[model samples]
Target chain A: MHKIWAVVRREFVERVRTKWFWVSAILGPVLFAGIIVFQIVQSMGGAVRNVAVVDSTTDKLGPKVIEALDASGSFRATLAAAGPGVIDSLSNLVESKQLNGFLIITDDLVQTGRAEYQASNLGMQTIESLQRTLGKLVVKARLEQRGVNPGVVDWAQIRIALDQKKISHGKAVSDSATQSFFMAYFMAILLFMAILLYGVNVMSSVLEEKTTRIIEVLVSSIRPFQLMLGKILGAGSVSFFQFVIWGVSARVLLSLRGPIARALGADPASVQTMVLPHIPAATLAVFIAFFLGGFLLYSAMFAAVGAMSSNEQEARQAQQPVTYLLMVSYLSILGLTNDPSSTFARTLSLVPFTTPIATPVRWTAGSMPTWELAASLVILAIGIVAVTWVYRVGILMTGKRPTVKELVRWVRTA
Target chain B: MPEPVVVDRVTKRFSGHTAVENGAGKTTTLRMIMDIYEPDAGSIRLFDQVGGGRIHSARIGYLPEERGLYPRMRVLDVLVFLAEAKGVSRRAARVKALEWLERLGLADWRLRKVSDLSKGMQQKVQFISTILHDPDLVILDEPFSGLDPVNSQVLRDTVVDYRHRGKTVLFSTHIMEHAEKLCDRLCIIARGKKLIDGTLAEVKHTHGGKHVIVEFDGTQGNARQIFADRQLVAKLQDFGQQAELELATGADAQEILKALVNSGARLARFELASPSLHKIFVDLVGPEAATAAASGARGANGGANA
Candidate 1:
């Protein structure tokens, strides 16, 4: 154990002190800072919509619609006079770039509740707000015509907001699907990138050691299994360090969003919406567990590849299948996020190859069953043990790179 | 004491092909003793610990034929780390490594990256790391293959020092010179089989000493004819002033030397000569096996073996 720890310490310190580690470590936070700065700068450049309203209905809703559109404070609504040529005139204004878009309320709108919106780019947010504003106006005009009690109508119009809360144990916690989605997305990418970077770091280290013949010296004093575990733990710790740094930096930057927004002369209120998602302690534990499991599974295979290979090119060639396996898990994150409890998604979460990223994502989607998580963890543990054993025998191999068949033979015969 | 290492019919075949063909079995055999590979059949005992039993890794120092250290690491750090990994504490490892560095004349280069050092320097550092933990049994595979004469001398002296410290130093080499010079007991292996095993004197004695050398001032061309009556000379090389003669089996070297002196020749020198290790190796293992062993590009023939 002490020897293993020594190996781990050496691997960690030697690699951590490298310029590449520092560069990549600082690079992540810096990139995220740059993104926040970019968002702030974009927000500072305000969005102004110049929309014209064309009313062809006998209800003569153009002026009222103009007032409502202007009241939204996002669009500058102009009343285009009702005429047979109003559509052509408004479209001409849009084509000439004077208007961002034009909204047409036809006589059939009251029955169909359909209105035409044309723009060079009709953003979803803009379209949703436009519909809400026009729908309210049409409803009010119809209500007044039907002689509904004005006071009762005013009371009935009051919108009651539903507060979403998730009950865990005895406490109700605020749960936002949007927040969960964003959180899951962030963590999935974090896990994928971390695994790829550090797992390959282990691979390349093994290959370099093998090529330089340092492994022979190392194995002389420690079992190859100890060496492999120490290295995986060492590199995994570095990845964990990076994860913590990025996580803390993200939290700090998120909390500083208001000041950053103010610095950019943008609205602090808008920036306040960029809150850090609240990850439950249990969920955090699960995330870390799966992260390690996934990392170990791949890193062990990579170490085997490194041991079997004679050089960097050969190691890379041998690593292709495993790399593709990782890529498949990463690419499947999107589909898993959409339907975390779906048969395909749940099944993938059970598979050792995809379980690391997929299981955590399913958890975040609030659909991961406890049994599945436990089963995957067990499967991953067994896989790590098997891979470590196979690669320990592999580290003894020298000279030419072994074929897949040869490696399998080593594993079986050993 | 129990033999430091014993391999009893140990065999390892990788994917149906034996590793012995290219003499790679040297490495494979060492690995089995180190428990890096389990033998397919037979058994290996280290200090009477059978079934590849747990020998403290620190008790054994192995310098594989493919010698190396962490190239990007500082020399001192690499050595200390290796020692520590062998169960030496950090402080003790550091002091010992420094002592070794100084002894190897690499004290000044301790702070330098291994890559910054020359190949020979790196090799010396690697050698230090192997024995820094003061292991009881030191196994070096082809230790002198890549070294220049000076470094090889340095390594040879180190191995002598190890033996003086009462350590069992077992090293594998295809080149007979290193084995002949350094080993008290030697084994010649070919095609994964031990062809010869004995002390240096014993092996030479076994190959016999019926060879005689004579340096004379008189007749040079008639020397072969002088011994022709008894057909005593199996092979003879006349070097003008000096000649060598390998006697036929049962032919007496003393009788031949006396005959040469009585042939009215003023003799300058005459002595029976024992076969060299090169001759013994070629004779015992056969020339083809020696050729294949030397083909690994790590062995030297020392003129005669060539």
Candidate 2:
């Protein structure tokens, strides 16, 4: 045990001292904050477009269209009298960047519901806003023509919203669908990144020792199994440390969102709409358990891959199967999150390979049966033991990477 | 006290390849003693243990034939970590590591990464790491294979020092001169079989026949004629001013000396002594094996010598 601790200390201290660890650890939260800040800035609003409304219809609809577009606040609209040279001049204005765009209301606009928008570049948001304004005006004008009151039409246009709620423990919870989806996605990605990153770290560490021929000296002093275990635990601790840093920083960033938004010239209330989903203690526990189990299972297999490979290039080529396994589990996360109680999600949650990621996502996205979660944990534990057996045997055997048949043979015989 | 190690008919096979087919397993034997590889047949005892179940690694320091350390790690840290793995306390290991580093003339390089040092310096650091914890029995496989004469002499002196301190040092080398100079007891292996093993004197007396050394004043022309008599001299290795001869079975050494004197050869010196370890090794393993061993030593020493 002391030998194992020594190995663990060496692995941990050496890695933690490297620039890569700290850079990546801090980069995660920085990138995440950058995304959040970008979202907030985008929601605050974009630059208003300066455009003109050309009147070509027998009835003057240009001024009314200008009034509606100007009221929307996204476009600065000015009225222009329609003439043969009007469009050519507007096109030249757009070409020279003097004007953003122009909307032409033709005589057939009301009858044929047709209009032409000309711009150098048309943004989706600008188009959607313009469509909404024109549609409303056409409805209001039509209603007035049919002898209906304009006040009634305005009253009827008030928007209605549907409040989303999740049911938990036989009661309706106040969590929104968007919040639940985000929380599930965040947990799945966090678990997946932690397991894959730290697991590969273990593999590269093993490969370093093997290629350096340090394993001979190490195995002479301590058991190979102990050495591998120490490495896995050490790398796992570093990953967990990074996770703690990211989690705390995320929390701090989320709590300070209002001040940050205000500092960035965005309305604090717009940022406040991004309320985090409330994670229960039980769900957090499940996430941690699955993370650890998944890390162990994958790391042991990666260690075996490292052991069987003679060099870095060989190890990289050999690790594809293990990496693909993790990728398959990760790709299934979206499906599991969408329908956590579906048969596909439930089956994947029970399989040890996918259970670590799948089960946690399932539990967070929907109500999972306690027995299913227990069974998944138990099977994952068994998978860890089996992979550890392969790791113990493979770490000492150096040569070409073993085939799948040979790996199975080692597991069976060892 | 029991012997440091005893191997009783131990054999090890790796898949289709036989690592130790017969008794010629030198490195394989050391690995079994260290419990790095288990024996397929027979058993091994270390430090008087009944079976090679668990090795008392703290008591045994091993330097593998393939010499390497964590290249990116500091010399001091690598030594300390290895010592701690062998059950030494970190504080004690650190102090001992520094002492060894200084003794090996690597005190200034203790903080430098292993890769930053030259190959010879890295080798010295590896040597220090091997015995840093002060094990009772130190096993070195081809320890002097890649060392310069200066470094080799330093390591040789250290091995002798270890003996004076009552520690058992078992090292393997294909260079017969190193084995002849440093070893009290010697074992020669060939093709996974032990050709001979005993004290230096006993092996000489049993396998080495009558041997004579003659130093002549003149060049080889006169000596070659006298040594050309195959019936008198079984084998002759002629040097410019000196020559060593192995007498034929039942041949008298006095007769050869008389013949040299009568042939008008100026004799500087003549004496009869036990055969050298190199001669015995060549005689036992044959000329081909001797040439192969010599070339292997030269190749391994080429890096340091250059």
**For this target, which candidate reaches the highest DockQ against the unseen true structure?**
2
Label model 1 with its docking quality class.
medium
Give me the runs in candidate 2 sitting further than 4 Å from their true place: A25-102, A106-110, A119-121, A136-178, A195-198, A244-270, A338-347, A367-371, B21-23, B50-55, B219-231, B234-243, B291-306
The most accurate candidate by TM-score is 2
Q: Mind giving the per-residue lDDT tens digits that candidate 1 earns over B1-306?
A: 467677787778776877643223677877777766677777887766764523567787888877777888999999888888778999999999999899889999988999999988888888888888888777777788889888898888877776666667778777777666766777677766666666777777887557777898666545667756456887665567877677887887777766766666777788778766766667666667765342111111121112
- Which run of 10 residues does model 1 chain B get worst, by summed lDDT? B295-304
* Root-mean-square deviation of every model: 5.8, 5.3
Classified by CAPRI criteria, candidate 2 counts as medium
Q: For model 2 chain A, where is the 10-residue window of minimal lDDT?
A: A270-279
Clashing pairs in 1: none
lDDT at position A314, candidate 2:
89
Tens-place lDDT digits, model 1, residues A144-225: 7798876766677889987877554455678866677777677777767877888888888888887887777676567788
**What are the per-residue Cα lDDT tens digits for candidate 2 across A1-414?**
888899889988988889989998899899889978987787675547889888898878888899999899888898878888999999999999888999989866777678889988899988999999998988887788788999999998989988877786576877766776676677668767876777798999998988888888888888888888899999888888888988898888888888889999988987745545578888789877887788888888888888888888988988898888888888997788778899999899888888888888888766788899899999998888888877777776766667779878888987
What local distance difference test score does each model get?
Answer: 0.77, 0.81
- Measured as a fraction from 0 to 1, the native contacts recovered by model 2 come to 0.74
Q: Write the per-residue lDDT of candidate 2 for residues B144-177, one digit (tens) a residue.
A: 8878887788788878777777777888888888
